[model samples]
Target: MTIAPSDSALAPALRGYADHKPDHLARLHKIEGQVRGLTRMVDDDRYCIDVLTQITAATHALQEVALGLLDDHIRHCVQEAVRADQDTGETKYAELTIALRRALRL
Candidate 1:
């Protein structure tokens, strides 16, 4: 199969999630608050361990968001694309493997 630089079919199809953007925004806002709290902890001369703990929590929160987004992509974007064209299963599988590798690196 010819590997195009872009998945034109999936790109347009995946943009149909306008119904639940508020949920994503809410998660982002929570993460934002966590970051702000971390900043304040540093500014207030909090203990090193306390600051590190908050940092870990914020990192985990970010990871959770990333995982959620990835799951959505797999369930919706990749699922639809593969269903639309059965031959794309290999290409989509490769893409998921690459994404999983990057996530693992973090």
Candidate 2:
């Protein structure tokens, strides 16, 4: 099957994914606030363990956001590629593998 990059079939789904930007930004804002709180915790000489725990929670929250985006990309872009009878699954898999490796620092 010949694949054309200009596939209109995927546009709507991609747009839907783009529409998620604002919500993602809002989540980042909250995460930013958590970071600021963490800074203050350090300045106030809060318990070391408590500060560490907050850092862990913040890391997890950020990971959750990243995972959400990855899932959306797979559902939209990757799925569209597959339906287009292109080797989109393998392409997306490789892209995601690289992304995961970078994000996880592995």
Best by TM-score: 1
lDDT of 2 by residue, 12-78 (tens): 6444258578877888899999999999999999999999999998898898788878877777777
C-alpha TM-scores of all predictions: 0.80, 0.73
Mind giving the per-residue lDDT tens digits that candidate 1 earns over 1-106?
2444556655553343445567777988999999999999999999999999999998998898778778877887678778888768667777777778899998
* TM-score of decoy 1: 0.80
lDDT of the candidates, in the order given: 0.78, 0.77
Q: Could you tell me how far off, in angstroms, the CA of residue 35 lies in candidate 1 after the best superposition?
A: 0.7
- Which candidate wins on lDDT? 1
Give the C-alpha miss distance for residue 68 in model 1, angstroms: 0.8
